[model samples]
Target: MDPGCHKLYHVHGFDSRQFLEHYLSDKADMVFGEESLKFPIENLTKVFTEGHIKGDVLIDLSLSSMVHHLYSACEFFNHIIVLKAQDRCILELKRWLNTRTGAFDWGHATKLHADIEGKCDQLQDKEEKVRSAVQHVMRCNLEQENMTDPIVLPPADCIISTWILGAISKDQDEYIRYLRKFSGLLKPGGHLIIIEDLDGTYYTVGNERHHYLTCDEDFLRKALVGEGFVINYCKVQKRTNMSDLVDYSSSIFIAAHREKSV
Candidate 1:
């Protein structure tokens, strides 16, 4: 969902159900396998129940809308892991979370070390440069397979990747590979929530044509189940403007516990 809808649905005094219904009706093309009208009710209900924020640690992959939702609804967690392809998103989240008034100080210490590596030419010291080069090479090699460089992190209780897997890769195999990588990040019995673009969206954003890997609820459910995750809850809805100038429809995924664990 877009930031506007996040504020609309989650903020005080707005009739969430009414807004969702109107939003869904306006973007019928994106609703998966059902009428747009029913989708709002179904999605809202699941968001209330399954998306209920409860966990010591939370990981948000997209680092935008999902992070906004998680932060707005819940305030406390032992640790929160946010994964993003772009450094700007990560930095923005860190800044936003820190400004919140409470014991929850989203400070730099709260940010777990990232998986990114720097280039050899960027480092002045020879020894440091060599190490950086090696790490950079290793990360590049992993990226080819849609895998993330492994990093030691605090134990997490919840994992959220919203509009990330689909938004990052257009290749189906690559998309699935990234999904598997995300699943591997979670501990046994940890919750995994994902929101993605359902329709094959090809929209323009700042002179770039952003493409999405078209996927349905069944495809995602099957993939997650095959990867040892049990479908606690799932929904495919037409979300409000996922982009700024590019108003395209999208879908959401909310799953939990990799079977027999949680």
Candidate 2:
């Protein structure tokens, strides 16, 4: 199985951000019986806007598909490190960073973000802000003891991995192990943001079908607590048939700080 084949929910290359906007962030279909429920990206914007933590040295443990959610984070962080297991993913991200002729379309995502933050007129400006914040795109292996070995790096103020552990982890045991390893990359009291696919065993990016480690909030919460994390905020977005193409049922987004109890 090609390990890098896993995608951001159902996105392979950039297209419409509709999957993100309507299904993930929209209230009509996304909210069940909660108090104005929002998706991970939307919640993340609120988190950043609340002025909680400025992840100055943010480490993106896995570069999933798009950096739409990290746009707000760029406004707070000085440096961003994006890591992917495959060379193609790294190169594709580099192509976008360097502004190559055919970079994947991220305009749709930026427009959505602008609407969320009420900054509609500054879409282009926000895009550049994200571009400038991302400083490194490195290759990494999630299986290794130290994912980014031989490349000495500073302890991250925050680490963000969206829908990656499920795609790469062999099973629940390995998922817990990976969580422990990721925690070491952060400083004490640092933040860890993880967005996962709930109750998803498979997702199709094209004609090919890729498998993921199916998990839910209970399992994930246990894993995080096992790794010495305190949950701050968690949002679960129930999937609507809006993106009926993808097999995922719900998207889980968690933001926890690593301020372990004594």
Candidate 3:
């Protein structure tokens, strides 16, 4: 692993397909299957079902081409906008949305969502829902003050970010700074749902190691509060499986509402 590759979010270096295969494949273990996939899917389903996180526009800032996190969200938010820092990721997502050949299959994830939602027979329907709801897949630059510059986005009713922050931020302060940028995208009192790898320093993709921030519950709570978010629900699951591909102790899911600007 090159020391320089572990410093910042290198847009072109990530292998989206390999990432899916290693961490979210059909044979994924407890860490990726349960912590990464099931935790967010189940919690987001519950939050949306509770009728409090109402939203029309939702922006997703997940890493790579992963769409498993959006299965439940598509049911709640009418329009979904996926923002990615890498063009490769955007292209990958577009391939799936356009039903192009060589696109990654999300059937397993869709089935999981159907099973959790108690509508097991609607597996194909759930997949279609996600495809239909996603209106745009735009490239983003997290280094820029306005990540989606030159194409200003409407204030989103909700923002769901997963794993991107940890990969983008090199330190805790940088994490809080990037998080503030996330807060700026939400409407006042709008919801912000974040799912992150907790206390992780690095994860590998096709032999390339990527940086991950090592943040704990206290730092995360303080960071959210400092950014004017009132956390409504938070859950953390300890890593149940060990792997050299990734080094993370736990995963965290937090549902918060941005404070109304006074």
Candidate 4:
């Protein structure tokens, strides 16, 4: 297939609801649950539990319209601001936040989170905490000087972006460009956490095929150092699920902090 024919996720847009059901749902036999649900939740829980990443404001730029990743952060952060490139993603999140009808069931994710922390009985409370911490969700454009232009966000203490760089960036240069924008949003010495599927070329959601920037651990390490971020933690889990919809060898989790001088 010609790269030119690929449907660019940043340009062609995405189906947020379908994306959730396909990748994050428990009932779906897609095998993405291990990577998309459990892997991130468990690793994020560990990173937060270690007490290394601490802050008041947390900005989330994760892939799709998911809140499972924030299950751990809400326990640590005072506020969470979700930034999305698509309005549908915002609407999907709003549906769940407002407790409206047709919201995607996140019970499985909540259960996974609670079980990992050995607080299975507090599942409902865990869900509510995430809702409470997420005070705002706004549209973002990575190309703009201010992603949330006209509304300059205060320098964040920590920012977490998962898989979005892969979905939006067409190449390494573009990925670094987005990374610079992400760094700009953070204050000096601020933390940045990223979870990405390494070496993936593309992924399918519903009937659309979205391009993924092919990258590996070495490239990411060099990129972060070049951007003046000191890597705090990095982990890679080999892909265990065999799926035809996406081609990724492994998933990478990185925790880093931007230098004050750079």
The model with the greatest TM-score is: 4
**Which stretches of candidate 2 lie above 4 Å from their native place?**
1-38, 242-245
lDDT of 1 by residue, 1-262 (tens): 2222221111112222222223222344433223222332244334534445455655556522222234221333445555555433334434433443322221111111010112224222322222222111111122533444455544456666655576555466767777777776666777677666676544332333444566677778777877788777766556643334334455565666665431
Give lDDT tens digits, candidate 4, residues 7-29: 77667788999999878998758
**lDDT tens readout by residue for model 2, 1-262:** 3335554322343222332332233354543212112365587797778887686799886534457768888988999989777666676667778888876666756777788889999998998998899998887766677677888778999888876788667578978877888788888999999988787766544344555777889999999987889999888877755443446677788889987732
lDDT of every model, 2 decimals = 0.45, 0.71, 0.84, 0.90
The alpha-carbon lDDT assigned to residue 252 of candidate 1 equals: 60
Better of 1 and 2 by TM-score: 2
Top of the candidates by lDDT: 4
lDDT of 1 at 216: 74
Where in model 1 is the C-alpha error above 4 Å? 1-53, 63-66, 72-76, 98-151, 239-250, 260-262
TM-score of each: 0.57, 0.83, 0.94, 0.97
lDDT ranking, best first: 4, 3, 2, 1
TM-score, cand. 3: 0.94
Q: Please, what are the lDDT tens digits per residue for candidate 3 over residues 11-36?
A: 44587888888887676352468776
Give the C-alpha lDDT of model 4: 0.90
10 residues in a row with least lDDT, candidate 2: 14-23
**Regarding lDDT, does 3 or 4 come out ahead?**
4
